[model samples]
Target: MPVPPPPADLTTIAHALQERLGPARWFDAHTHIGQHDPDGMTATAEEILAGLDHAGHERALTFAMHEPDGYRQANDVVLEASRASDGRLLPLARIAPGAPGALEEARRCLDAGALGFKLHPRSDAFALTHPDVDAVVALAAERRGPVLFHAGRGIPQLSEAAVALAERHPGARLILAHAAVSDLGLLAEPAARLPNLFFDTSWWHPSDLLQLFATVPPGQILYASDMPYGPGTFSAFAFLRCCAAVGIPDDAVREMVGAQLDRVVTGADPVDLGRAVGSARLGERSLPLERVASYTAVAMQLGYRGVDATEAVALARCGAQTTGTGPEAELLRYVDGLLARAEERLAAAADDDAPARMAAVLDAVVAGFLAATTSAGVPPVAL
Candidate 1:
């Protein structure tokens, strides 16, 4: 299946929606500032800032990536970046719980101005139940700081392990990165049971976010891009799509986007910022809608046809409802029409290759829409 170009009117509607949302302040709760992996994942503070700027995020809680020396140097770099960022960047010291002097290192970083700490059990090769991890959690609890754990689809750092750890230190604010990635459903009960446990939106699947929003209290969820490692722009879009799909209230959306995290870090009351509507501001940031449209156009030009584009169209229509206006209703109908056409094309297509190709194109279009809406620079197309 080839990707079809989005209609010009569709692009215009997307832009209009972007403009209506206005400039939102996003605080990415999970981001890394250093490169320490064999997969060539590396980002400097400058690059991290650039990504943040592109995404219209005002601040991020960043930490060092995995390092060979127990993140000693990486922690220093994060501290330095945070010091120089004028509060735009908040440092979260990374610690290998099993390493010697880990607790002391965490204390030093906290005293040096780190707002929280991050632990990656998978990368550090330690279980969450380790005594060292307990010690780190204890320290964070004593200081009333947040601890972000890399809990996803794995043995040692699964959502269950995270729940057990959170249970031990009920006072500590523990964030489960990637929304517990593959185990959102399993963690829903624990998420509700543990008040100090929070989840971040960083995974690519919009469904996961939708489930999280639907199953968990809105206040317990935080907006995060996992920038410099994950697709920051796309992650933001996925979050938006989730909110739209779930019909999350505007005030709740605001809190999930940044306010909740702000309160956690600053101990301030969650301000009730009104809905993001009306005309856009001059020079305000926007997602890369044109790039997405162009990519879709190129895919269609290549003779691709599939149901994936139809699904994306449906998702966009759902997103239109978030605005709750007549114009948005009309836009939804327009997108529905496009979806019907795409479905017809998909039904008529005979080639088996169309599904995969169309899926890739739809994914790109969604990512592009996300980037365009938020004025976050578009990431390179995977296809």
Candidate 2:
């Protein structure tokens, strides 16, 4: 089935807000400029520059994709591109903790004017708290730049592990990319506790971004697209829509969009970390149509098996109701209902291990839904 378009008013508002903010003040904290993946996804420095131009961004932190032969050559590509761009692009080197000479390579990149480092624990198949990863974080601490970690939906480098590492290395500016895309609530307390830990809004989920903005301090959030790898234009547009829909203050939105990142890259006094502005205080604007669509898509994509026709119809009905109400309260109730049904099903499962596994998935879904709904100014409803 074809996806529906967002409401015209919502799109207009998002574009108007984007225009008001202007691109010069925006800095994409995460992006890549090389070929690496088997699917042949590649982005050249010029293409990245054009993307930034199209997005109205003045600068971006650019890095190379993870190369199979290690990132030595890839790092060289990023350095050359940044040098050629004359500072329009800031370079970060991608490092595999388990790779040979990873520490030495990191030091070399830093010396060669690389601004920071990017680590993907899932791709590298290493633990976030591994000694070698610590070595890289220590390197970033010395350089006084951020260490961006890919944290979501993968093994060994979950947000909790990243939080532990950030706690251990107080001096390192650790950025949890994708806002810990899957388990953002898990990072809330850690983000509040660790002044050095930061979050980048780069994932596709609006609910996660809204929760992060509501839960984490403004200073701890950075705007990022993960562009050329993820959809560049869509990501930026979605971010703007989220800011508008959530009614974030203009000044705070400005910081999340770019200013705070400018300070971080320049080694200036860090933006002051403040207490979280809870969802109720943030704003109670109606959820945008695009966001409702996002929520429905996620619900339909839930991997639960044995979803009978009756359950599917109920889920669809809830989705339709959410669209009509345009209120997060309705969506929250829908998710709560789904969770209740999942629990009842698990209770009757014949296999013990099946129940345990299903329970884990349901638990994650419930946590995410509650976080999003709470941030959207909807009180939790008992299941």
Q: Compare the candidates by lDDT and give the number of the best one.
A: 2
lDDT tens string, model 1, 88-135?
A: 888999999878888889989988888878998877889877888888
Model 2 steric clash pairs:
23-56
TM value for model 2? 0.73
Q: Write the per-residue lDDT of candidate 2 for residues 57-162, one digit (tens) a residue.
A: 7788988776777889999999999999977899988899988899999999998998889998877778877888888988887756889888767654476677
TM-score of each: 0.69, 0.73
lDDT of each: 0.63, 0.66
Error of 1 at 288 (Å): 26
